[model samples]
Target: TLVKTKGKLSFQEPKTKGSIRTIKVPDLAIQTLKAHKLKQKEIKLAASSAYKDHDLVVANWTGSMIDPADINADFKIACKFANVPQIRFHDLRHTHATLLLQLGENPKVVSERLGHADVSITLNTYSHVLPTMQEDLAQNFNVAMQNIKKKSL
Candidate 1:
């Protein structure tokens, strides 16, 4: 990640091998991304000769790396606009993991998305949400057994 300072931006590679894995995005996200790409096309046309064609998914209209401070400021403004609690940009990662776990996504999948070295880390980090998932699983099992018995008769 690169952080923009007054004079320059700093860059560094991931500290661990686990951070290099790809994330599987859902269809809805792909759709939204396509829409965003279309918007970027409009922006590129507007910027015309000045736009750098680096092919960034998220960048300034001139196709430059956006400033970190600007991203944070925009995030804060968006939070206010959406009437959500004020949270730092880093908090979104935690929120994404928590919401997905609570919604019963596979722990291994979540771990991969989070770039955790192993699934155990994801399970341990979100163990509090597991009890409810366990209960739901048990209920689903009961329903399945009932359906089997009815079909057998």
Candidate 2:
């Protein structure tokens, strides 16, 4: 939705007033997408005459927009199979942001990838992740203060 691959998917305007963004896909998701693409191609060939044609990244058996409800149902089933915690689909996005922030990633980088119009948008959306970094900030401040005091002495 952010990067237009071959101009196939273009975002002429931001989703919101502050929504221009680009993001890197993790290796796992990329690989999974590749696999899905291959499978989709196969399915498309096999059922070319049986279904309507659409080139969506993901789709239903009939090559149509998968209903939002169906997606949630499938997500829940997959989560149950994986023994994952009871997090909503939106929670996955939060988890991704939280992990990146906790890992000390640059907010600018993360925010851009999340397709936020600006760093502040990304920061605001994931502000909860910043609290965990307070300890690190405080420790650095203490060290800097001690250095200044020693120099003055």
The lDDT for every candidate, in the order shown, is: 0.87, 0.76
Residue runs of model 2 more than 4 Å from their true location after superposition: 1-14, 17-21, 137-153
Estimated TM-score for each candidate: 0.78, 0.71
Residue 146, candidate 1: C-alpha displacement in angstroms? 7.0
- Please give the distance, in angstroms, between residue 96's alpha carbon in candidate 2 and its true position after superposition: 1.5
Clashes of 2: 3
- The digit string of per-residue lDDT tens for model 2 on 22-137 reads 45688999999999988887887788877576677868666666655566788888899999876676678778887888888899988866667789988888888778788878
The candidate maximizing lDDT is 1
The Cα error of candidate 2 at residue 54, in Å, is 2.0
> Alpha-carbon error at 98 in model 2, in Å?
1.4
What is the alpha-carbon lDDT for the whole of candidate 1?
0.87
Write down the worst ten-residue block by lDDT for model 1.
2-11
- Name the runs in model 1 displaced over 4 angstroms: 4-7, 134-153
Residues 1-153 of candidate 1 have per-residue lDDT tens digits of 666566786657777887777777889999999999999999999999999977778699898887777888899999999999988887899899989998888889899899998899999988988899999899999999999999999
Task: Count clashing residue pairs per candidate.
Answer: 0, 3
